[model samples]
Target chain A: MLAALAFVAGWPLARTIWFGFTDASLGSLADAEWVGFANYLEWFDYGDGEGEWFGLLADAAWWEAVRNTLFFALVTVSIETALGMVVALVLNARFPLRGLVRAGVLVPWAIPTIVSAKMWAWMLNDQFGIINDLGVRLGLLAAPVAWVASADTALIAVMIVDIWKTTPFMALLILAGLQMIPEDIYEAARIDGVNPLLVFWKVTLPLVAPAILVAIVFRALDALRVFDIVYVLTPNNASTTTMSVFAQQNLFQFDQFAYGSAASTALFLVIGLVTLGYLRLARLDLGN
Target chain B: MRRAVGLAKRIGFWALVALILFVSLFPFYYAILTSLETGTAIFEPNYFPEVFDLRNYAQVLGQGSFPRNVLNSILVATATVAISLFLGVTAAFALARIPFRGRKLLLLTVLSVSMFPQIAVLAGLFEMMRFLGLYNTLGSLILSYLIFTLPFTVWVLTTFMRDLPIEIEEAAIVDGAGPWDIVRRVFLPLMGPALAATGLLAFIQAWNEFLFALTFVASNETRTVPVAIALISGASSQETPWGPIMAASVIVTAPLIVLVMIFQRRIAAGLTTGGVKG
Candidate 1:
């Protein structure tokens, strides 16, 4: 029964994957055309006169979306993982008002992503924003800058907001992992004259490897699928278009239903591959 | 020398922790600070709070769709939690405790579904919503949001269910208890924490959901907090009002913060234990 309920819950996912291979369109299901491999074929198009797969493979825009999505995922996940680990280490230590501070740290995580994006968008506004005020005051820049208007800074601004909101989640997960490490291991390491760094590298690292992998893998998958932040922050800004945003653009905004489904199917494949890699690294025995 | 090193580590740790907290909180604090300051007061050229006023909060709360949206969000999230939990717990119990063929394949399917991208289903889901005559309704968003929450609830609850001792359940069976009775009497009480944790996860996921809500609901009555604030485009070509947005943002965030603050340890344990495989 539990499995059934889970299945019902996940039926939408199956519906998504199944429909991706079809020529489903905005029209009714009766009007749905079955076009096997046609959607996938469109993913590789290069806009050539040949109208063949050869031309499709050279599509720069598709490649750019892939590159941008992967780059964003890699940078954001790596930075958040590193910073989150540091936060975990620091917060793991006993201190005054520790509980209070621990709870306070979740403020960012609790804020909705859209609201966070909008708030940061306001702060990063070029003209009357306080970020420019502070940046100029602190001598970080010679003049006030509009952070979201330019291609160079648009992606970075989105990344900054995401990092701000999600790093606490990373920290919280790592902190939970940290707490599970018995204090005696560190004591033994200290008694053996192991420096904290070596103790971390040898003792803590191996012990916490599974948890860290889980956190990073989850965060990475989520980051790769990022849509809401980029969509709300830089809608139609082309430069900040991640794969999901690109898919949405093709589907809803542009009304290119087939093309959008193709892009979404590609994203599914990429995420599926990542999830496979994660399962392998974490040794999660799906018991296949 | 040893004492000095220990003291330094403590101080260093506290300072670093404080710095992290500040950076984590600065934007929200600044938002609330800016919201409290009158429009011109924000131009005073400093990060400090100038004159505190409730005008922004009042304006957003009383004069906009924010309060109504909050109620809509609460209703949608609460309904989502109830329905997902009921179905998820039942399914989890069946999967975890019941002996049935194809269970392994079923479990794998559940896991895969849980991880599949929502976008993959977006077009189909949108079509389904329209077909079912649920488009632009709270029911539409609630059902759609389940695509994310249900698999998680079932997966996490199964894990929790699997960990519970079966001997007590068997003893109850010896007392001639039926499956429903066993679930109600023997298991439900024992699974309180698991249920609470899963329900909390479901609620938060629903509350913070944006994409489906954005796509599915097209009316003010159905818009959730995230979508409401996200799509808060001002009238005409005027800019987004940061003060009201922040005020609304703060209002929506306050409850979640309180939830985390009260359930800090439980939530942390829930996330780590729920996600990580042994």
Candidate 2:
């Protein structure tokens, strides 16, 4: 089993790391010569402030993708975490038809990201989209807005779709954490006549913080690597291109295999460091 | 006065519940409604199902390589689930029941493997597929999907195996049941729920995976549901075939929705345990 995982995952990871150092291309993977630090240098080169910056670090397009990815991750994670907490709190309450609602919430999450992106892309169509019609009807917009087409609103459009599809996952995780809190703690708070809001702030939030943090880290990592939604919703649009999208475009479309590998290697390092930092901070033990 | 305040709260809460339900389900409901509308009906912004046209569904299923893509999705997802479960069960037994050094490290390694960005491995994996002559084939997808699916299966199954009462295992052991015998004859029977939950989750992951399917498979017939739906275009590049797209989306999502509804409890348990406990 370990060998299978190593071959499928580990070996490829090692190959990518190795390729990041060499001038490997799609045409010549085996015959690629050693070019230690050249790919990295080219990626980080400042270009002496001349005309037309080169390398990923100096490239405006790469920076745009990085900014879009981080902004998307930050906004979506915040909104989803807040909304997920609310939904989990609501669902945690005893209510009629709760199971049905729970099942309903999972529908969006269960749907494929590509499918959801397509559905939203159609719904956000400027001309005959229901969203525009409703926005007009509600006096939200004077006319139809091209939600995914225009650069101004494309990131927001992607974020909305992401929040819709993934908030359920966050809610489900927090709901599990909520269910774990002992009933007596709430009962005690009620007997003490504490403010309901205060009770939630003091008792519930602290107890569920671990689970919420875990969910946030997971979602953040996922959003950092956002690809399918951006790719399908706004293909080749620099305004919404994420790190993964940029890497994929370069790797496959441009066939700059070594340069793309460098980008991907950098991404892998960032994700790896962040994950390690989070694990260290959270002190989560998988063996337990 | 108190009664009035309580009444207002109840009304507000129910309203919120209604809003949540609408937000959660309205898109799919609209997709279904749109799928049932023909030619010009879809152009108009109609909320409810005005027309009962089955042509869109017929069109998506009847034309092109959609049915073939759906078959490919099913085959790949089922194969992934079966293989992941088989590997996960045996690995979980070793990691869960066996007392050995470096077990923790091994388990952590499995956990971290799932978290690697797919892009990080794409170039290498693509090269690998070509080298093995598996590019554009279903074999590439099924194999690449293991990078994501196996870790979760192993971790979740290991957690489930740990929670089982140790007394039964000891009893079986006293009767001379070896590790393989114990895992197969004894524990596997009791692990039906865990197996089902993990298998379903793995199936969903494989079905929804896009990057690998998009990159690895080039032929139209080998495309999975996600790639096929994504690449679905109209007769001309000017316009998108929304009606057929919605129809196909509905078809692909229906099975998942049904499965989720049926196994909500188990799925929730699996996710929470995997997330929180891990």
Candidate 3:
């Protein structure tokens, strides 16, 4: 199985890294020539202060994508974590039909990302969408707003969809952490007549910190590499393009294989470094 | 005042839960609602299911290549789950029980492989598929899906297997059982729930996968449900067939919802274990 993984994943990764440094394109791999750091250089090049910056680093579109991804990750993960904690806390409380409610929460998470994207795309449609109608009825919008079509709101629309689909995943993970907390801790705090807010701050937060950290890190990585939601919801929308989308567009749509590989490699490195940073901060040991 | 505060708090809690449930399910509920509306009925923003129409579902199923796409999705997902489980179980045993050298490194390597963005492998895998004459075939999808499926299956299954009692295996070995015998007779039965959980998760992953399914396959006949639904066009270029798209989305999503409902506990166990351990 390790050998299989190596052949399927490792070999391809190695090839991508190699191809990133070459002049490879579709259907011409055999005749592709080696170029040392040319692709990397081209990605970093800043044109003489005249024409639009062509290099990916200086390119406005790429920077917008990077900013969008970062903003998306920051906003969504934070909100999801907060909302997940609240939902987990509520579920942890003694309530009737809790199991049914818990199962209900997983519905969104179970729905395929693409399906949800399409669902939201339609729901956010400016014309004949229930959301717009509701907004109009409730006086939320002066008129029906094109949620996903305009550049100003496209990223926000995508973020809303992502948060909707993934907050359940976050809630469940945090709920698992919540379940691990012994009742005695809270019982003792209650006996001491500690305020609930104080108890949560002093006990619950510290105990669930590791789980929340893990959840946040994982979700952040996922958001950083987001493709399906953005691609399906806002295809080729420069404001909403992520690293994965950009790389895929270059490789498949535009057929700039080498340049695409370079972009992909850059994404890989970014994710790897962030993961390493997280591991170090969390002090997580995988050997066990 | 205290009783008032308590009542307010109680109301607040239920209201929050209701909001969560509504937000979680409203899209799918609306999708169903929209799917049941035919013609210009969809154009009217009616929240309630006023009319029941099966035409959209029939349109999606009876129309060109949608049924084939659904079949292809089922075929690829099932094959992926079967192969991933078979390999994952055996690999988990080796990694968990066999006491091999570099086991830790191998496990870490497996974990890392899953983290490599799929696009990083797109160029390479595309070349490889073409080389092996597997490009645009279900075989390409099965193989590529393994890139994501195998790693998590092996990781989670290994964690589960390591928790099983060693005495059971020892007792089997005392009865003159070989490794394969131990696996088939002793371990397989015990692993039913774990296998089901991991297999279901793998199936979902394969079903939901889009990047590879979009990039690797070309023909409409070969496309998976996601690509099919994504490419589902309207009567003309100017308009999108939202009705058919929602119908197809519901068709493809129904099985997943059923599976998740049936196996919610096990799925939760698998996810938490995988996340905490990894």
TM-score of 2: 0.96
Predictions: Cα RMSD each: 3.4, 2.8, 2.8
The Cα error of candidate 3 at residue A188, in Å, is: 1.0
Of candidate 2 chain A, the 10-residue stretch with the lowest lDDT total is: A44-53
1 or 2: which has the higher DockQ? 2
Error of 1 at B257 (Å): 0.7
Question: After superposition, which runs of candidate 1 have C-alpha atoms over 4 Å from their true positions?
Answer: A1-30, A35-59, A280-288, B1-4, B43-45, B102-105, B276-278
| DockQ, structure candidate 3 | 0.65
lDDT of each: 0.79, 0.90, 0.87
Model 1, B1-278: lDDT tens digits are 99999999878877887798888788888888878876777555457876889998998888767788999999999999999888887888899999999988887776666566668777767777887899899998887777667777888888888999999989999999999998889888998988887788778888988878988888887789998888776676466677788888889888888888888777776776555210
> Candidate 1 chain A — worst ten consecutive residues by lDDT sum?
A49-58
Among all windows of 10 consecutive residues in model 1 chain B, the one with the lowest summed lDDT is: B269-278
Clashing pairs in 1: A1-B91, A2-B91, A2-B92, A44-A56, A45-A56, A46-A56
Residues B82-141, model 3: lDDT tens digits: 999999999999999999789999898887777777878888898888888998999999
lDDT of 3 by residue, A1-288 (tens): 977898888888888888888889876987778987777654433466444334456556566767887888899999999999998898889899987888888898888899999999999999987788899999998999998899999999999999999888898899999999999999999999999999999999989987888889878888898899999899889989988888888887888888788888888888888899888866654433
Question: What digit string (tens of lDDT, one per residue) describes model 2 on residues A59-95?
Answer: 6777787889889999999999999999999999999
- Candidate 2: misplaced stretches above 4 Å? A43-53, A280-288, B276-278
TM-score of each: 0.91, 0.96, 0.95
